[model samples]
Target: MPRILLIDDDEQLGPPLAAYFQRFELALTQALRPSEGLALLAQGGFDAAILDVMLPEMDGFELCRTLRKTSDIPVLMLTARGDVMDRVVGLELGADDYLPKPFEPRELVARVQTVLRRRRTAAPAELDPDEWRFEGGLSIAPTRRRVLREGTEVELTGTEFELLLLLAREPGRVFNRDDILNQLRGHEAELYTRAVDIVVSRLRKKLEPLDAIKTLRNAGYALALRRLP
Candidate 1:
């Protein structure tokens, strides 16, 4: 069973949700305080983490930032419904995905499963090369699940790496927001198009000097880099 940690201050939220998650064969552990959650995470053995943005003691964003300094464990953030900035900030903080409050447990489970899938598989296709080399010293090794920029290793979260891999597989192939959200999240979300833009912005920053991703006016985004000869 995959273990999951949920960091939320809602004292009444854990037991019932834990029971629900158990039905899916996922072991859910709840931490009512950020300090407690950080302690539990420090002990290790969690496959993923679900954080509530409104938590006490430095909030979920700070916890995520601190945790990211040491681990790449998949993260799903719970944001306030209708707060676009909340979702955007979570993604900006390296959250693998986000779900709004008042969400169905079933939907949350589905999102968690999608995040796990992303962590497991990132390459575009089975027949693609083990490593993809692009122009301007960018290379992605799918087998190793690593990216290198100009010969130096670049650290990317699972979501970021997966998006990059998707675009690199077919350089210049336009991937509209809906398509990207589907490919990456496994569900259609009308509000998540901005999520795509936020991720692209992050990728652009990390891939500086190369201008590796191009935005097509109202069409979509594509890998601007070409394969290395």
Candidate 2:
């Protein structure tokens, strides 16, 4: 059974969501306070978490940063504010996905199932030697869960790292938005093509001085291994 910890201050929303998840094999736990949520997380061993942006004593973003320090447990952040900045910030903070408030219960369930499925399928595994390296100074160490550019370590969140590795694995191949989403495979939340673009943009900035990726016009992105003169 997959365990999910939901941290939200919305007294009305939590129980209903919990009840809904009960219908499935998922064991849903709710924490109304950030402190309590962090404590439960520290106790360990949850398959994933659903967090709300607003909370008493430490908001969801802070809690997410803290969690990423020690664990790679998948996180989905919820907020009433539907600002693009908030969603992007949450993604950059290591959240697997973000859901705005006023969402349908069925949508929430879909997102949860998607996240859990991705988690199960994306368990770290050994990478093929060919899939692990980029000629222009990029390399993925799957065993270490690290990315190196010009032999220097580049900090990447779990999602960002996975996106980079997936692109790098098949150099020069243009992956459409749906293809990338399917490749990511398991987060039932609404898939935004913009999210993929944002992740790729961030990776490009991080891989500066060694151009390892190129955006193909109207086609998606490709890993360019050949060095530019």
Candidate 3:
């Protein structure tokens, strides 16, 4: 069973949700405060984390920033419905995904399953050459799920890493918004096109100086780097 840490202060939300998750073999652990949640996270044994943006002391984005500094545990943020900025900022802060509040429990479960699946299969057992080297000193090792620039490791979330891998695998192939969304989520989200752009922008920022990603206005994005021999 996968253990999920949910850091939200809603006194009424956790219990019933936990019960519902159990039906899918998911164990949900709730923390009423960010400090408590961080403590639990540090102790480990969590498959993923679900954070609520509106918290008492510290917000979810700050917590996510702090968590990414040490752990790459998949994060699924819960934000207020129609809070576009919250969702975008969460993704930029290294959250694997986000689900707006006022959502169905079934939708939440689907999102959790998607993120967990990505985490479990983010890396493959073999690459034709084990490592992919690109111009401007960027390298990716799919088997290890590691990225490097000028010999230095670049930490990336599972979603970011997968996005990079997808584009890098087919350099110059323009992946439109729908294609990118479908590739990442295993389905298309017509209303979440901005989500795709946010993720791409975040990935590009991490690959700075190399400029490994190129954006095409009104179209989509593609890998800007060329394979190195």
Candidate 4:
């Protein structure tokens, strides 16, 4: 049974979610306060966590950061705001996913399952000698679904990691916005294209030592494999 810790101040939603997940055989623990959730997390293990952005004591973003510092336990943040900034901030703070408030319980369940599945599938493999290495400190560990810099781990949101992995896999291969978006999300490409650019910009900033990724005018982006001293 996958143990899930759900932290949300919405009293009415907690028990029902717990009940719903129980039917699926997931062991669920509900926490109404941030402190309570942190306590449970510190005490030990959980397969995943569903955190609400707005908490009485500490907000989900802070909690997420704190949790990431100690453990890589996948986290899904809940926010009623639905603002893109909130979602971006949550992701930057190392959240696996963010579902806006007033969301359907079933959708929540699906997101939880997706995150868990991703984590489970990400088992580290031995690095191959001929693997592509970006000039900057960035390197992708595909099997592990992790990115590292100078041998130090860099926390990446799920989407950002996918984008980085795809681009890094084929260095110098320019993937237009549509191609990249479709590949990253496993969905049809959007007509209007800024989504891919946005994700790439966010990813580039996180990948260091800087200048490893270059944007092509009227084309797309490519990894600059020329090493930097």
Candidate 5:
């Protein structure tokens, strides 16, 4: 069973949610405050995290940003109002997925499973070379899903790595927003178009000085670097 951490101030939320998650073979651990959650995460047994937007000690967005500085654990955020801007900010802050308040337990479980799936899927067999090198001293190891810039390891969130590989695989091929969303989260494409841009921006920042990606006015993005021989 994959271990999952839930950080929420609502004392009533964890027990029932944990019980429900067991039905899907996920072990749920609870933390009532951001500090507690951060401490628990520092201990490092969790496979993923579920954060409620209305958290104590710190809001989920700040917590997510702080977490990203040191770890790339997949994160799913819960928005109290199901607001679009809230979801967008969560994505921008490195959350792997988001859910609205008053959501169905089943839907939440499905979203959790989807993010986990995205976390594990490497890439298409044929394109997954042991490692790929680009012209600007950037290299990607498909098996480890790791990236290096000028031989220096560049830590990336799961979503960021996935988006990077997606563009790197095709080199110059342009991928529109819907195509990326469908690849990232098949069910969220229509509602989360801006998500692709968010991931692209995040990925670009992390792989700085390489100029690894290019965007055509309304056409979309592509890998700007050529493969190393």
Candidate 6:
């Protein structure tokens, strides 16, 4: 069973939802406060998280931002309002997906599964060995889902890792926005193209001082590193 941490203060919603999740092979652990949720997450063993936007102290967005500093576990945000900006902000903060409040429990489960699937999926074998080494002190271990710069591990969100892997697979090949969206998510939603840019920007920040990705004006982005023998 996949362990899931649910950080929401909905007393009436948690118990029944926990029971329902068991039917789908998901183990749900509910935390009533952001601090409690952070504590539970620090202890490890969670596969993903379901965070609510409205909370007692720190809101879900704040918690998500703090959590990203230490953990890359997939996050699915629950927003009380159906605002696109809320979803966009959550994604910018490293959330994997979002669902509006008053959502069907079944739909929530489906969204959760989708987020988990994206995290669990492996990069194509055409990318080469489980481990990839590149010039400029860069290396990637796909099976372990890790990136290293000069022997030091670089922390990256799931989306960032996928975006890096996709570009690194074809060094010097500029992938346009729509191409990236299709390759990563299998659909060309314009809204998500912007999300891709945010992810790329975040990825570049994490890969600083080594300049591995290059941008093309009016085109797209490409990996600028050469494979190291």
The most accurate candidate by lDDT is 5
Off by over 4 Å in 1: 122-126, 186-190
Output the lDDT of residue 28, model 5.
93
Top-down lDDT ranking: 5, 3, 6, 1, 2, 4
For candidate 4, what's the RMSD?
4.2
The sequence of per-residue lDDT tens digits that candidate 2 reaches over residues 114-153 is 7766544442444444236667677776646677887898
Q: Which residue segments of model 6 deviate by more than 4 Å?
A: 185-190
Clashes of 1: 0
Spell out the clash pairs found in candidate 1.
none
lDDT of each: 0.86, 0.75, 0.88, 0.73, 0.88, 0.86
lDDT (tens digit, per residue) of candidate 3 on 97-178: 8888898999898999998887667444444467999989999988677899999999888899889988988888999988
lDDT of 5 by residue, 1-229 (tens): 8899999998998999999999999999999999999999999989899999998788999999999999999999999664888889999999988888988989988988987887788778888889999998999998787899999999988888888888888899999877788778666544566888888998999899989899988888999999886
Model 3 steric clash pairs: none
Sort the predicted structures by TM-score, highest score first: 5, 6, 3, 1, 4, 2
Q: For model 5, what is the alpha-carbon lDDT of residue 64?
A: 97
Each prediction's total of clashing residue pairs, residues at least 3 apart in sequence or on different chains, is: 0, 5, 0, 1, 0, 0
> Cα lDDT of model 6 overall?
0.86
> Candidates 4 and 5: which is better by TM-score?
5
Per-residue lDDT of candidate 6, residues 1-229 (tens digit): 8999999998988899999999999999999999999999999999999999999999999999999999999998998665777878888898877888888999889878877776788777776587899999999998788899999999987778888988988899999988787755543254576777788888998898889889998899999999876
lDDT tens digits, residues 51-98, model 1? Answer: 999988889999989888887789999998888788778888889988
Show where candidate 5 strays beyond 4 Å. Answer: 188-191
- The TM-scores of all predictions, comma-separated, are 0.89, 0.74, 0.90, 0.76, 0.96, 0.91
